[model samples]
Target: MLRNMLTRDELIQWMRTELPRLLQEDPAFRAQVIGILSEALVSKGELTRLLDELRAMREESQRRFEAADRRFEAIVEELRAMRADFERRFEEVDRRFEAADRRFEAIVEEMRAMRADFERRFEEVDRRFEAVDRRFEAADRRFEAIVEELRTLRSDFEQWVRFSQQEFAALRVRVAEMGIGLGSLGLRMGQGLEEVIRQVIESFSGAGPLKAARLVLIDEAGELYQPGARVEIDALVTDGRRFLVEVKNYAKTDEVWAFHRKARFAEAKLGETFEKVLIAPAATASAVALAKQLGIICYTFRAAESRETSE
Candidate 1:
């Protein structure tokens, strides 16, 4: 019964140790155990039944083991397929990694080439800039030379200006001396001309227009002459009415207007209308016009030319 309860390895161990001890403990035990087993043995029919049950159990267990073995083989085949799929995917991943590494290497190489090209171009630009700097230095030297020439020219111009100023001052002094002499001569000539005109007026006596002709200096008052103004008349004559003549060396329009004002003042003072005349060496066109507008006769006398009258 204990052997039946034990596993195959446990049953072999118990028999190896315990069977010899039991035989030594009882000499007749073995025969008695055989006689009891013989007495307790099943009949032939019972033994045949037991053998059939055992065969049936053995067949069942074999069938079960075969089913388990088939299941294990199927599981092993599935695992093998999974492992092959994993290896194929891993190989694809390795190829992808290699391709990416190649692409990265290409990019790095391209960048290195670009950097080297840029460095070379920068060196060329630096050389160009150096050449430009050399040209600027040459231009600066030329500019300095031009500046020096301008400074020399300015100095000469300043000296010329100073000499011209000195020469102008000397000429101005001579001109002033000549002006004084001319003034004295003009005064003498004017006095002489006045005397001559007085003689002419005197000779004109017993004439038609100049029957009572005489030269007189008038004192009068107007814009050009205040009260008691000393005014020189070139001739005081009677044409049908009184006449006042003005004598000038050179007559301009302003002198004509001034003489008209004096005539006005004289007319006011004497309480009589008088004809006005201007005598000169030469009169400007504007002076002749003004004299005509003012009803003043203008006469020009030159030794080399004919005596002209403003009609």
Candidate 2:
């Protein structure tokens, strides 16, 4: 059954595997192959040659096997050398890594020292700033104290100025009072001179009203024009040929003009024409001129004789 299942290539492969063993152990089958070669005209020399070639081929295959074995052994020895070199290089790399780790640790230590120094410097700077702040505070206090002193000084200066002003005002008032008192004394002396001039007129004229010394105020009750508004006549005669007179220590233009106005006002009140007269111990030229313009008589007294203008 097994021989029947064998294909053509299987039968050939089976013969190839068993053919050499059959040739070596089976002498009869070998002899049969030889007989067939002889029948095909294979001579003894040819057989000898064939055997020598086969022997030679076996020797060559044996030499090639020995060369391949030597090459394999050399390759194994080269791989072992490469492994040893790789092991030495790995040991060097491990040493370098350890040195690098030591360097990193040293750097870390230096960094920590630097950090401590920086912290100490920062603390000292903070203290310096605090000291400056205190100094500024002291300076501010001193400045405020100076400001207060200036304010006090200014207040005192103002008070002194006010006191000076009040004192000056009182002094001016006293001076004015003294001037009024002197003026009242001068008026009394002028009135006495007026009386004396009236007596001189009576003696010179051989007198009727002049002998009476008729000195009067125009409005004795102050009821003529306004209350407390009255003018005085040093000498007056109202009976016949009336004369309205005024007396002055020194006759000025203003006094002459005022006397003229009083005469007019008195004429309006009494409705009578009177001669207007002005008498002065000393009279300005302008006063004499003004009195003449108003058609009044002016008389000035000299030590020698009386200076009079009849016109």
Candidate 3:
């Protein structure tokens, strides 16, 4: 019988398994066990009081849980409202961004059109500038050509002017020689040189330093023209100034000597100093030399003209 009896752990295990089943399915057995436990742990009035306190605590816990649920539902509603507002604000921001993008696109399109037009106009202006540059280059070449022409003309003109000056100088010299030739020709024509000399002496008196008080022709009445005077001297005495004069086409050294002798003889007769003058178209260099040696001033047309005739 002892071997067939349960051990302490087996009895505990059986109670742990069967006690909840007995309480759930055996009403009479559950009541008997509850009565035994209640009587052993607490009296009837104490147990009744514990049950009442437990029921009040359960009802208070239930009310607090229901209030917590109500507060959680209100927080959920507030979160839903915040989410909706955020979504609406994000939509509004998207619409503003879309509008800004459209405006930017329109501005870009306008800028593209303006850039195209500017490029076209700039190309036209560049072409015009190129044309103007070409024209300026052509004009510069023309001006260069004109300047070269002017330089050539200036050189030619300078040469022509030099030639003209030389020709004119030669012509003037030829004309002077022809004038002297004409005078000789008049002499050859036998045109009375005495009358010509008379006119010359009268005109010389008008312009000479000594005006004529009277013209006494030594050839006519003076002792210089007496018979065998050895020289036919054409002489004039004016204002007591005696001048022995003669004219010839060409004078020689002997002719100049004869005139000097005539001057000496006239001085002897008139008792006055006489100036000797010989006028000729040309004379030998020897005749000019002798006249200078004899203190006779001679006037002639030759290279020695400068030495005798400064006036």
Candidate 4:
């Protein structure tokens, strides 16, 4: 009985290989196999029900599988669209990057050109500066030479100025000495005239020669010859009357006025009448007029010169 039982694959293999031979050659074995199979298999009603359930399960599984297949195809189509869009965007980005690279290369080339031009200009400027420096150096040398020449001229001019100053000093000293000599000669001539006047007074008035000459006069304070204490008198002679005389190389109005004042003062102090006389080699017209106005006598050496020449 255990051997008679057949597995599902053994039953299917026997049906495929031996069922035809069994139906023709062994009708009784066929009936026996049918009975064994009938016992091993389910009842017809149960088999029908099982087949219906299997059919329904197959239809459901088929519907589910088709729906899954359709969903997978839709997903695949959407992924393909997304990939195409990404590829197109990537291509556009690549084109933009290429354009940017070209623009950067142009800018870099322009910068290089500008730098080259700047270098050339700088070199030209340097050459110009060098030329200007040379000119300045030449001007400086010329200015220094001019300064040196001016210094030499200044030295020569200073020497000339010093020599001129020395000459002027010597000329001034000579003029001063000549003035002193003329003053001394005038004094000596005045003294000689005083002696002559004394002789004339003794011969004309019969007053004997004066005993002593009055070199100075006195007042209550001191000697009257204060302003000209060092100076000698021109003439001083007395014949019981006072006489005042003044001599000069050249007499002007000022000398005549001075003589008048001295004569007036002497008369007031000595209580005697005084005779005033002025003598000079030449008298200015103003001195002669002033002498006549003041009642003083003026004697000029020019008259004596005329007389000597005439004789």
Q: For this target, which candidate reaches the highest TM-score against the unseen true structure?
A: 3
What's the lDDT for all of these models?
A: 0.71, 0.72, 0.71, 0.69
Residue ranges of candidate 2 with Cα displaced over 4 Å:
1-195, 203-227, 302-311
- Cα displacement (angstroms), candidate 3, residue 231, comes to 62
Question: Cα RMSD (Å) between model 3 and the true structure?
Answer: 19.7
Model 4 CA deviation exceeding 4 Å by range: 1-193, 196-214, 218-233, 303-311
Per-residue accuracy of model 1 over 162-262 as CA lDDT, tens digit each: 99999997776455434434543565676334333433334333334343333444464334556556675555766565667676767777788888877
Ranking of all candidate structures by their TM-score, best first: 3, 2, 1, 4
* Candidate 2 lDDT trough over 10 residues, lowest sum: 301-310
lDDT of 2 by residue, 1-311 (tens): 86799998999999999988998899999999778878987698998999899999999988998898888889888888888988888888889989988998999999999999999998999999999999999999999999999999999998999998899877754543343334335556663433444554453345545522434445655544465555766666444556787767677788887888778877877788888777666677878878899998876542223444544
Those runs of model 1 whose alpha carbons end farther than 4 Å from true positions after fitting are 1-195, 198-223, 226-228, 239-241, 301-311
Point out the higher-scoring one by TM-score: 2 or 3.
3
